[model samples]
Target: MECTGEQFCSIIMDNMVEECVMVSILEPMGVVTKKVKGTFEQIGSPQQYSLCDHHQKSLVYCHRTMELKAVTIQGGNNRRARFNLSRYSNASTTTTNQALPVVLGIDQWNLSCSKQTDSATPVLQLERCKDQLTTIGAQEKTVRFLFYKNTTGFSLTTFESAMYPGWFISTSLEPSQPIQMCQKQDARKLINFMVKH
Candidate 1:
């Protein structure tokens, strides 16, 4: 597909799909590495995003703590560039308001959560870059994220690990606390975030 200035496209996997757009390179965008037809193509480009926590206000990366933290943001804060987002390609037949596959990144690193260990809840962390939606046979990557959107007239979204479906990315109500995963039925309001593209 022709991507010209923020088109609605989903690159769910490493390979291309029918509904997926070409925006491959995440860090530095607009520099086409390969030649498709002696022209430049937008390959793997990542759009900088700021996730607003419903309760804590701001979801940011704590450089000192080396992890994501929840705090107050006034006037968009100064850490918007710390996070980036891209949608994973989904080839579903029906176009319901269902959760779409996506990949969350902290700059160049991709967000990932391991499967529950010893029945313990999984925590979200940034790891080396990889196409999370890339699957082999029946095995899906742990780096994949499920993007859930709430259509209650507000742009609220939640990121759940594809490895574990019900678990979501959450933050603490108290400021400066680390961000982790929580259950859907949890009474906390931190899971729902307003994704500012």
Candidate 2:
């Protein structure tokens, strides 16, 4: 499942004109309330955070409807993924809600949805999958990503498709569609973003 706008809050960087998906980390005391703000272009920039000292053992979170939700990817014959909205919480308001399920859209580069249908679920076709994400109308292949945190905060650092290298993860114009991997020179600059709350 691609991390598009369906589950994530997409923010466009003013200066660089790049859009990044907002991902959060689950903290023990409560969800980390600090907001991560920075541009991927400036790798040397400092991040402002208000997180706890123990920032370990955290899970990936997706921001939806101003609330932070937990993300889970299913295993086994059914490669389904969902976000637990029941655990939804508002860091600023300090409010919690009942847990609900949001189905993930497995269209290689698209985000997940709340619909409970098979067509809504994306199928990962390894052999038929495209060699690059940028190539649309390719086979369906779900991808795993690698995130890096340098001097910057916990934003997306760098990512590669499951079977495709030299091609990195990226988003296209329509947020409803799957994100693509491009070979263009600026593709890296477009995807190597910081993930913050």
Each model's Cα RMSD: 19.6, 23.9
lDDT of 2 by residue, 95-130 (tens): 123211111122232221111355532222212223
Estimate the TM-score of every prediction: 0.63, 0.23
lDDT of 1 by residue, 1-197 (tens): 56644343443343565586787522211111121121111226556777877664677776666687777776746764356666544342122354555566775676777755575777677667554343311143543343333322356567665556566787776776777878766665367677776
In model 1, which runs have C-alpha deviations exceeding 4 angstroms? 1-44, 74-76, 92-96, 130-138, 142-152
> Candidate 2 versus the native: TM-score?
0.23
* Alpha carbon lDDT at 143, candidate 1: 30
Q: Find the 10 residues in a row with the least total lDDT in model 1.
A: 27-36
